[model samples]
Target: MRVTPQPVRRQVEERLREAIITSRFMPGEHLSDRMLGDVFGVSRGVIREAVRLLEAEGLIKVVPNRGPFVAFLSAAEATQVYEVRAVLEALAGQGFAERASTEEIAELREVFEELAATRPGTDRMVLLNLKRRFYGVMLRGCRNAYVARMLDQLLNRNSQLRATTLSDPKRLPQTIAEIRRIVEAIERRDPGAAWAACREHVHQAAQVALRILNQQARDEAAQGLEVALD
Candidate 1:
């Protein structure tokens, strides 16, 4: 059997998507096709194709004359994303609790333990990777193909918003505790409790993210007011 090579366009698109998701290319920052082509060692056409893919993923926006820029999420959009995520995640948790085998639960537990062992001052990237792995296990064990697919599409924006939420020094412990609660419910095979735990975790995280966004908006408004008065 011949092995199929991954498409160059898809490879470029994944790199660009990861860059945007990791905040390497910050939201609203312009992406130059020539510069990106140089950096990726690809042609302008390839870069453009990759960028259009990212645009479809909602990680980039193309302006007619201005080219493509990283997508920015407003507080309202973030709230809506998290609200939908809460429902989907709760469903996943419930499904996992109801269906996951003993071996699968053990695998998820191991991931959770690794996550819990992460120190407060550990690198954010490390924590993010562990969190991703934990959720990967959950998605696999949950046995809901449609829910997995839907959540996969939202993962990039979810990563962007999570960076903001997890940046708060006070939130790390709370996040750990929330995950612990969910895991405990799953371990007990309590679908209702697991669903509630998952929803509550997302709800609390949304509140933190919304608070930060509101504060930033207020600061921007005050600055504009000062400029007007002057």
Candidate 2:
């Protein structure tokens, strides 16, 4: 477990953010202040302050009459995220190819191998952690602080919405192939190829994810129409 350093409130805030991202708290789930206070061993005031921080981050939704609930995005909102991510990650990939040292390139290759070895039935959290590690290497090796900062914001929200896409067994092989192209490009220090590969990877993931979200929306609409006819 990673220990968060801070005043009580920041620690609690990170705790809540991780929970929300991991689906431990879950989308649209009511967050009871009392329950959080008991669980975190903090006072209600501390919970409120922490929740307020996440509300500003767009992970928590606070309504006029209702208390805080985990925020769930519409498909349109998710589309914007993926579009932004493609450009940001592409830049990071190009930068890493141009600037990363030999060791950094090798480290990325090793991480890619681990990811490729993962079977379809592998644990969800494990895959997420590995993917995070892979991106961490790319960001630091890229040595661009500005791009890293922008990607961090999108990644926080994107992870929550990517659960369905990442878990699709049908996409696993394609994902590995896409990421392998990125690793190979970076290893060869081909900046343009790395950029294109990264952009294409995000494009493919967006397609799979958006398709699922749209289908779910259609299913819900059809269900509501049935109730109306009743």
Alpha-carbon TM-score of each model against the true structure? 0.93, 0.93
Query: By summed lDDT, which 10 consecutive residues of candidate 1 come out lowest?
Result: 160-169
Residue-wise C-alpha lDDT for candidate 1, range 1-230, written one tens digit per residue: 99998898888888888888787898889999888998788999999999988788778889999999998878898888888999999999999999999999999999989978876777777777787888899999999999887776776676866866665568888998999999999999999999999999999999998888888889989999999999
Give each model's clash number. Answer: 0, 0
What is candidate 2's TM-score against the reference?
0.93
Give the number of the best model, judged by lDDT.
2
Q: Could you tell me the lDDT of residue 104 within candidate 2?
A: 95
Question: lDDT of candidate 2 vs native?
Answer: 0.88
Local accuracy by lDDT, each model: 0.87, 0.88
Report the lDDT tens digits of candidate 2 across residue range 22-77.
Answer: 88988889998998988899999999999998888778899778899998877898
Q: After superposition, how far is residue 88 of candidate 2 from its true place, in Å?
A: 0.5
